[model samples]
Target chain A: MQIAKVRGTVVSTHKTRSLTGTKLLLLQFMDAQGQPLPKYEVAGDLVGAGVNEWVLVSRGSAARIDDGMEHRPLDALVVGIIDTVTVENNRLYSKKDAERG
Target chain B: MQIAKVRGTVVSTHKTRSLTGTKLLLLQFMDAQGQPLPKYEVAGDLVGAGVNEWVLVSRGSAARIDDGMEHRPLDALVVGIIDTVTVENNRLYSKKDAERG
Candidate 1:
């Protein structure tokens, strides 16, 4: 699993039969510090993450294993919403702090 | 694509033939605000994101398209390192800020 923000949703009407009802989001990969990473050749979305909204994203076969997702052609999915981040060195982070800081 | 830290590399010596030479990193998902998201039921890495490191990860068929990666059974791969993140609302976030803040 990777950290990403649900920038937007992917709507493919003529996709593979396995990818029927999977919700594909344009995920922007983020660093541990909650920074947006540089994108390479893939196309993603610019959803309103508000600078900090830790999100859980799944890709590959794992992505295809979401609820109601099976044998689909999905490559990614927003699986969870983050609430807080606790790191060593007495460094604690949260979505609220990311929005404020 | 998603943001993740290269916590550790996956080494499967007796796995699929297509998955040769592919580096599998245990990835911990983060939120948009840069917070860690609650994991549902996926085994990932704790390779040390250091609270801030924007790394790019590719999954699914896309992950199989990396250089020297073809017809492999790989599900994920770390493709790039992030430099900076620029969001609206005047929130200019970077790797430096994520580590410090």
Candidate 2:
């Protein structure tokens, strides 16, 4: 799993029929210090994550687990919402901090 | 599918038993112009692709199709090797070029 920040939403009505009800969000992968990487991808929203929220993204085949996406040709998926992230016992990011300002 | 170039190989002898016989190769994603993206991943090799070969990577659940990975937790499988890539009549990459130099 990689840490990512939800950047935007994707509203696609002309996609394949199997992808009809899936929620797609634009994501920016973040480093441990909460900085965005240059790579960005569109991922399925499985946890109701809103824009600007920090999330854990599961890539590749792991992203297609049991979501009616078995045949939908989806790749990246938002799997969890991160409340806090710490590295080497050092505070890096916290949802409370994002909520405050 | 995305274009990726195999950079190296991974020799993991202590991994899960399900992955015992699977070949894992390190890959770097490539941009349309044949430059490498800043991303690298280890993917299962099904087509016997050697190092430095430009391959077409099918990501997400699509990566786990067949090859007896249904019961195993594996992601990022190499599905195909690219013969050539042409965009707007421009030859972006070719196996012949990679074989030349």
Candidate by candidate, in order, the iRMS in Å equals: 11.3, 9.7
Please give the lDDT score at residue B93 for candidate 1: 38
lDDT of 1 by residue, B1-101 (tens): 45444444456689776655544555665454545555311112212222335554555564454335556655554444444533333333355566678
Highest lDDT model number: 2
What local lDDT does model 1 show for residue B33? Answer: 51
Each candidate's DockQ score against the native complex? 0.08, 0.09
lDDT of 2 by residue, B1-101 (tens): 45689999989898888787888899999865568999888888767888888775556566565537555566676655666665434566668887997
CA deviation > 4 Å runs, candidate 2: B1-101
lDDT of 1: 0.48
RMSD of each: 12.9, 9.7
| Clashes per candidate, residues 3 or more apart or on different chains | 21, 2
lDDT of each: 0.48, 0.72
lDDT of 1 at A61: 60
TM-score of chain A of each: 0.67, 0.93
The 10-residue segment of model 1 chain A with minimum total lDDT is A40-49
